[model samples]
Target: MKFNWMFLFTFLALTDLANAQFSSGNQFFIGANTTVSIHGLVLRPTFNNTVWSNKVLTRSPDAIVGEPTASIQQVHTFNEPTSFSGLVGLTYLTGNLNGNTEDDLQIAYFNPDEKYVTTTGSTVDKTIHFVSKNFTGFNNSFLRITATNANSVLPVTLVSFKALKEGEQAQLAWSTSDEINSDYFEVQRSAEGKIWNAIGKVQAAGDSKAERTYTFTDNSPANGQNLYRLKMVDFDGTYTHSKIVVLDFESNMMVSFYPNPLTEKLLIQADDWNEVKSVELVTKQGNVIPMNNSKAGSDPGSREYDFRKYPVGTYYIKVTRQDGGIRTQQVVKM
Candidate 1:
């Protein structure tokens, strides 16, 4: 079921991918917009969307690899059920690593059963090159960067961080698999993704190998476009931030459609579906985009739409409530 890369010895920089498996490649470039949301562990890169392959899967690391006993600080799980035995390289920006000492960092590969596999990476200017050979391959393996301190290790293994509107307040929640020299987590809020103000803080586990859960409530969140991020601070005052979770209440409409620049799927959330009569897609040209993957979104208050089949353009989603109430939102598919 695997197809070899059409090009024998060249690397390609694709933005988005739906369904196509290529062979003879272990290099992935995550640009400024690279969005990695593996099982609620979201990493929205400072860059735009880059290449992603289903075969080469990645998710937040679980409790299996807890302690850094093998010269590995943390591991990022990828390639489930698919073994890798060659080159595995990741090129990322220096700003994203949150490193106190980038000179001590290098990429390391691990086997499926939490065993240390061998690989090394180096930095060049603001770009880091984690390119090396992996002699052994296993399913459900890891692609990790060696860490010199607690600041660098906190991010890759974060379990999940989410934000939601709860009745009249905004709720922020997150969890961690392992922590080192941890002090506490400060929940910060911003009006439009800048000028953040610390809203609340929660105690951390300091140094623990167990899973820890944390939550903070912002009773007075901004009216709309509220940006939330966790300022994870260690005891030494070193800190790192999590991926920003956006909650927009700008619209007066009851139904909420997420990710204006639609990537793979568009999620529509509502408080209640009992009053919702119908939902469908509309184009700017008054054309209808019939969805083959309709009825996709599950229990987010509404249905999820797989807009991949349609061409890249602007579209409108019309929601008709039972009592003749109507709302329309514009979305652009990238």
Candidate 2:
């Protein structure tokens, strides 16, 4: 499956990587047409259960089957669908420096998912850095890595990220542009914002260049607050994280009124704005005032009530949800 054009998004920075060579005491599964040379660059796979890449790049010191340029490139064929990523360390003195300045260098790459050549790379002390994007659901494919002077772009361009609470689950939806595109999206969750765990993975549109949208659901969210972010991994091993999205899950918190002691308008927001059926205001004189979203230009998701017309006193806000549940909040319009 070939794409219209490969994206070359090679932005350079600094990141220390593993050793310069495929070190000793390591294992590799070299399939047909696969070659490796020592002295620089090692592609090793992680074998952890929860964090598995589904494959490994063999690190062999006694590897003597490939040409001298094996330090700068590796060609291999996969037997099954695999997603792998690793850093390659290439020095400038080894005759592979195609450009004098660092701006003219990039890793010319190819994989089953890519179908064509897209470039990405970085450098430190003239040392070239190559990391492969995760290849998802591609098999019997040849991966080619070489050196070149070109620009790269990420296949998928994120357009937006959003979150909302539905019935009993937290649903996250995101949109992307020109996604010729990613391998998969790992949905992550956090409680205290310090620790995060992978909750689910959504398969990417490995070969699409249209406006694409994807969604994931957290069926079991905490009672109060839940944090979410997307681990967006591309086919060539490049990865990035999306902005954090928060969803509040509550049972009794039907209505929330802000600026209790306000001189302006009082804003009323609900757990699910669409679920709100009606709103009522109670005055100190036991007078009932029917309310609508009075805040000028406020979105449909919020309700604004004009409290400036009333004098300073204790007032009450009553809200009825679509499910027939009701909650009232007391406010002061000072």
Candidate 3:
């Protein structure tokens, strides 16, 4: 994350071209880290020796050097000293900065020098001035350089997460290095591992210039081993998905009863039953009917239910654990 001042100088020299007669000096600092500033000055001669054009480039630590093809705007100028001061802003493509390391930020400018001299302060008060000699056929160009710790601003590293357990319900967690322009994080869980579905979502801290942490809890998980991943979305509609994590849970404890084509009442049971918390009766086509609920530490035994209230058909029985475990069985009401 250390700032490279030399690179900034080089980038600016190549970008700002203010006619064929201007040249800019290297950047100089003006304050402590608490209020640091960068200053660069460029002086160019007017069509005649009577007037000289000057530019003073100033930037803060958070300023971004835009693309090479960007246009420069003139903010203010001093006629006698041939100096100009203005705010420069540019937008670069996602992967164009700093050799594509996700850490490089630079702005460049080309200049032409006629007979202008540029100098920066040797101490704090980081100021630079441009002076031009009164001469004919003289012109000068200027470019300004400013830079900061690259790592402190860019978000390039990815966050990762893994699934630890799966069954009717699952648990999920993830981590990240930095987040920039991020909108939110989506938690996706899948029962088959191949087909993913959004089980839940957590809002992101959005455009953070530092490392960030995030987590999401999924209340509804599918039976058996479940797969989990994070889908990071940006405000600009861009997104990336994190690595997958898988957690497996035992399903043998599940109970199923079936005549499949039943008409009236259904039967349900759990082998060596110890305790059951809740049971859900679902039709073969996926309709759910509440069956019964028991207090914790309740004994598990054969259970029967009247389906007279429900149309004759096959159904599924689901048992849930207070600890978030689940077991399912098919039943028929005939």
Candidate 4:
């Protein structure tokens, strides 16, 4: 059954906007060149997590209608029954109506209630074409079609990345919809868009239905403004980068030492002492003195250090985790 094409366009556009708000998986494609065509449309086999939708605009039979009008067509069957399917219409317009010339078309889908599911192996197919009916006879032309699933689709919405001051370190956090075949995410920082360096990597949530959250802390962030992004990598080795988010980090942690020029012992204190993993005493000549973990319990507060064994001049106290993470401070040896 066919309805007024104008009415259908309005209805579908509104539906798409509403679906995007609540949908976890949504994707769409637009074409401009006449040679462009959509080939295959595939939906995930586990229809439980996502919803699918389609819109097609064919060249109008009557040129008086101006540009062709779009409409929502009947849902067609895909080779896989579990997945949804539908036909997209094609038509001729005022411009070139040659059999080889292509027409513009778009198809989009979203999953309002998607729960991430892992597929061992899967594939899908679709078809797109342009047809014209004139006084002479009827002619049809096919357009090249492409298929993309949840894992490959780019997110239209921008997720906010916030920076927080954690002691002397800066932490970053962001969130995204569930993904599939996701290997890991690379965190990059840039002073200018022209050059960027990988700061760290976070393992992806893999394939999931629920909203996933990720966080990364910059242990050695440069002073002033910094830019950050997630370089998402797929299991197949393919990858896509995310938009840049900028952050400004200000460090204000105070470090103080007592018993000036002390040969035997030295005391250190800092406000907001959460946990101190390890304490190290390094000499001016780059020699590391003996150090140890001084916290009494699982969580440690501020404490004093014993430096009596070594002679005094100038030295560096490097507090680090037994795992090798280091935090440094300069001190004077008496």
Ranking by TM-score: 1, 4, 3, 2
Residue-by-residue lDDT tens digits, candidate 4, 1-334: 2233344345543443211211112333222111212111222111122232343322212111101221122111221112222232222122322221132223322222221111112222123233311111122111211211223322322144566767667788877653645789898885323467999999987765355778999998876445566788877777767655554453244445556666767666655454445455654333445666343322233466666666756665654333433444456676
TM-score of each: 0.37, 0.32, 0.33, 0.34
Task: Give the per-residue Cα lDDT of candidate 1 at 7.
Answer: 24
Tens digit per residue, CA lDDT, model 1, 201-234: 8999997777788888888866645667788887
Alpha carbon lDDT of residue 127, candidate 1?
44
Question: Using alpha carbons, what is the TM-score of model 3?
Answer: 0.33
Model 4 segments more than 4 A misplaced: 1-106, 109-159, 250-334
Candidate 4 lDDT trough over 10 residues, lowest sum: 59-68
Instruction: Write down the lDDT of every candidate, Cα atoms only.
Output: 0.54, 0.52, 0.43, 0.43
Give the clashing residue pairs of candidate 1, or none. Answer: 32-46, 32-47, 32-48, 33-47, 33-48, 297-304
Candidate 3 vs candidate 4, lDDT winner: 3
Candidate 2: list runs displaced more than 4 Å. 1-156, 251-334
Question: Residues 109-210, candidate 3, lDDT per residue (tens digit)?
Answer: 222222112222211111221111222233323343322222232123354454444445565666555454568888876543346788778888875545
Best-fitting candidate, measured by lDDT? Answer: 1
User: What's model 3's overall lDDT?
Assistant: 0.43
